[model samples]
Target chain A: MATRTQAAPTTWPHLGLGARRALWAYAFLLVPLAFFLAIRLAPAASSLYISLHEWNIISPEKPFVGLRNFQTLLADPRFARAALNTVRYVAVGIPAQIVLGLLLAMALRRVTRLRGLFRALYFMPFVTPVVAAAWVWQWMYSEQFGPLNSILVALGLPTLQFLRSPGQALYAITAMIVWQYLGFQIVIFLAGLEAIPRVYYEAAEVDGASGWQLFRHVTIPLLNPTLVFSIVYSTIIYLQLFTQVLNMTFQDQGGPLASTLTLVLYVYQLGFQRFRMGEAAAATAVLFAVILAITLLQMKILSKPVEY
Target chain B: MKHVLALLAAVGLLLGLASVGATQQQVTITYWQYFFESKVRLIDQLIPQFQAQNPGIRVVHENFPYDTYNQKVASAVPAGQGPDVINLFYGWVPLYVDSGYLQPLPTDAFPVQELEREFVPMLRNSRFDGKYWALPTAVRSLAMFYNDDLLARAGVARAPVTWDEFLVAAEKTTVRDAAGRIQVEGFGIAPGGQDHHLIREVLFRQWGAAPYSPDGRRVTYATPQGAEALRWYTDLITRHKVGAIDFFPGANGYRNAFMAGRAAMIFDGSFAIGAIRGGTRAKWGVAPLPRRSAGGEASNFGSYWVHGLTVRATGPKRDAAIRFLKFLVSPEVQRVWLERVGELPASRSLVSDARLANDAVFGPFIQGLAYSRATFFVDETAQRQVLMDAVNEVVVNNKSPMQALQEAAAKEQKILDDFWTKRAKKQ
Candidate 1:
């Protein structure tokens, strides 16, 4: 009786159609907005709050330590190395993903036969379960009797310590990640390529433009939005790099002198392994800040106003 | 009106009886442990037996991958959920106790004196705050495992009894290529495995130093004697060149190499008895770890996994949890675990089993228990990692032994400080 005493604002007799529609839209939108706030924003805020305190999950007492955890992180060499490694993952991994993805997409655009098969072959790794892929990669990278080592032996080349060598472990992981993510990048690029009308290409050719000139002028500028999105997305992924390094590395704590350690893996070790949830939360807060700042910076720098 | 009131009271009494009947009929509880294939299989076999014995209580076993097991419990418990009973490495007891993740075993059912009398001395490592937080079915200590054929080929009739003889045997057993690349490592130097334990418990004590203070709160393994012990440990790799850290190059690489007969000898726990027996074709034997000098005191790192009743089990479930723990630690189950999982019986009575003490494969592990010392850890996994990092610094980066040892000491001391500090806050 109370709910039906008066209808909601959307059902008012004097309201205009647009106003009524907007009110109803908002009423429906609140469902998802509340869900987003609960599932995403709430936990993130709570995580930030937890970062300020000495929060061990199993313990009931969570006394606030007031940035002491962060202070510890600042002095932690593992934290420093992990942060640097995260940046390296982004700096080295993202560019390879972008360039290789673009090349593969372009080549696929040119192919006239077995197009579906080629696309499927390229995309399979992305769809394959990461844990499964990591184990396979671990075997392939084995120093003794791995398939890669066998190839090296057959070619009379020196065996490389792919995961065992501290200097090379990060790069080895980056290569695997690049291979796995290339399909996603390529698919996005292919769609961008398709959206570009053929008339622009013909228009360039008639003006005595070479193929490279046409690509440089026509394709590059038009693909600006797609490039910006990919760069921002890939940057986020590489910054939060974890599974490949964790699953591929020995003993699963980013060993080989922690060369392949990522910020997320460090956070995991802190919270779960060491039972220092406060430190882990502080580490995550730093990660969140880096991710947010880098993403905003990328979008701002890369987003150009394209004109036809 | 009086007759109607009487009928209502009878109905109420019947409903109360029905509810009591339901509560008494059955209570289901969950048990959790990390997945190791043999342990998981053994637990699976035992759960039914436990359920059958305790007809009113049903047991549900849940296993997670060893890597993420702790994380699963930590996250689940914060949300007011998880297992009624849990299994943990003995080293995790302090952390679990400090976090209040586990409840003290009911003293009425498990008297403190009786527990002390029945379980082996090493089981006392898990005790905190004047109460036993967990109990183990089996416990184990480190022993030297040698490839008999490799020793025979090197014309060494027996495993070395002293550090000097150990080096000579290692040199003779090592197989090298024309280019001096090691084909078969004389010693499987596994920092990931029990070698860290050997250095911490065996070497430090043998050379007249202790890894930690009496209370296990401070790091004290930074003395000249400590350096001598550690140098000798790392020297097997860098100075002696009998082995390299990356020879096999993966998780449990050293153990895998030993099982494949690519490495002549390795320090392992009795837990590897079943795995080694199954995985290797080589004729191998177990011997006591080498001492600093002949006829010196024997020292071993004793460790075990324990099952505990958790705080999550409340009221009626507490009894079921305790009952389940008792069945898990029973002598019959411990004996079967010895055969199946290769962990030694934690029972004091089984320590003198004639057949076990005289057996070739199990004798050394049993004897080592007489002097075994469990490293009471504030954080088991991290403390292990600190030693690994120390070893890696010396072996991988070519740092000095003393430098690595000092850095490791500082790091471990910090972990202890942070843990105790937080614990003090709670108290």
Candidate 2:
């Protein structure tokens, strides 16, 4: 029997039952690994190659230009404005969404009646299709006949130039985006709150800590992981912002002097509108670097484990 | 057993031969157009008729949303997967030609003399390297569309034909509320509409500066004449009090406002007539675009979407593509397109037809074809944007018209410089 087993081991490595199971596990993992490499990594690698050349998507000739495309992007004023707007999205939008979402989540935790219904209602906008939501927001922000302006008129107050004004368009769009994504942040915060051991809160109460102190000490610390995930996830979404700006701005897109233009929208304008595929690819590579850097910095600062 | 085996083998061979014969004779070709309700409807209706006429050929119809249509074509043609024939805006002819996306029409089949004489001269814009690349079934020209009751209320008897007269009409026809907010605009200010053409082709040229040289390399619109032309346009929004830029603000906002009787006058195109006709219960009239002076050179802007054969059509697919192209441009199809799509006929003969030419709503647009010039845009999207930004600089940012025009000229010149330099390199 020992000789036969030795022969089997030589013929097929991992002949034992545990080793066979391990081999099966590796086989199953290869499917997703192959999919990820093909679907995500291959195009990314190809895009990097294309960025070094003057790629005309239609024409056969894609002349190698090395760093010239990047040089053009760095000098481009439109690209500068788009990058600043992208930063504004992350700076203004993420904090507003997270704070509002956390407050709502905490408030809902105390409500006993129809708790599930409230959660479902709040979560609906997150699940709603973005195009439909964007158009709805556009109609709501219309300078002339939108309901918000109508309300202002009925109250004998001045109407605001919401989406049309250069000064207000960016913030107005950000507010709508915050509203759409708030429910997601709330769901995550609730799960984080639930995972906190109950004894910490009870022990704080027994030690004569006030309600505010209990929240600051017990609740806030435990929710750090959730907060970090939400911040990083929301930042990624805002960096690649395109659909809302495209739909809400409509024909003269990203305007009132391109107040709402984002880096992704600029990439689209370059690649599709101008057919400067090389420059667009260069812009995309910059965006990828910015995302990676910001996310890494966030993890470094926020990844402390709450041992308690 | 031998006889049965031979019989089975013979049956199999005969069926295989029949299939091969069928496959050899029959071929399918594809045509693509952006989704406009009327164009899509007519094309969908015409496919069966075309197939019936040529039983051995099949034409497939594909339509994409208007906004993403160009991008779709850009990606599809390069990947060798899109339509054999594509309907493109005439302004895009230069871009397509530069990219080698189009295959020029054969001179033997589509003679230059016949095309020059038969079609409106705008098809001349479709020529590149001295060869015609595309043809149109219908054409469109900018015209002033007015709400009759609103104009009458202002005591204006007919549509204003001169710039000063039109401004006077606009000021008088405008209605405001107690708070001085406009309830009705005299002239709808939508740069997204034909107003861009109004400034670029008609007013600028009529004022004194042709926007570009005939060869289209030089940017000639930065002169004093250009500043004056831009001043007149911006003055309508800022100083005139006849209309505001953001009063109604989408692609069709001004049109919708006019159709809803909220605007008295709008510089729109013949293509807008169908939407205005279908959307409103009010009385409306179409007039030729206003001139700088009462007898100024009757300048107007004309444009059309043309059917072009793509490089994708080759080998057996080329003949089918050409046949379908002919079907699309036939006299019968043009007449039906005029009725259904509200664009004027591209054929000189059909547009000059006594009955159709004399029709009140179409007469102004038809007359415009005589003097209308289709701008040879090297980059239509970028050029339009720079113009829009210039206007916004005046109305929104409070910049001077001359300064704005000067800046716009520099940007436009950069685009031209980049294009020509690259084209020279490629050659």
lDDT of 2 by residue, B1-427 (tens): 9999999999999998887687648888999999999899999998898988877789989999987887688778777789988999887776777788899997887999999999987777667778989899999888888999998988999999898999999999998775466789999888766788889998899889889878778888989999999999999888987886646655787898898898999988887877888997788998888887777878888899999999989988998899999899988899989888777889999978888767889998898887788887777777888898889888788998889999999999888988889888878
Best by the TM-score measure: 2
lDDT of 1 by residue, B12-97 (tens): 99998887687566888889999988899999999889987887899999999987887788778878778999999888887788
Candidate 1, position B221, lDDT: 92
Could you tell me which 10 consecutive residues in candidate 2 chain A have the lowest summed lDDT?
A54-63
How much native contact recovery, as a fraction, does model 1 achieve? 0.36
Model 2: DockQ vs. true structure: 0.31
lDDT of 2 at B192: 61
Number of the top-ranking candidate, with lDDT as the measure: 2
Model 2 regions more than 4 Å off: A1-11, A112-121, A146-158, B1-86, B108-114, B311-332
The residue ranges of model 1 lying beyond 4 angstroms of the native Cα positions read A1-38, A108-121, A144-160, B1-87, B101-117, B129-131, B149-156, B163-183, B307-333, B339-341
In Å, residue B100's CA in model 2 sits off its true spot by 2.3
Enumerate clash totals for all models, in the order shown: 0, 0
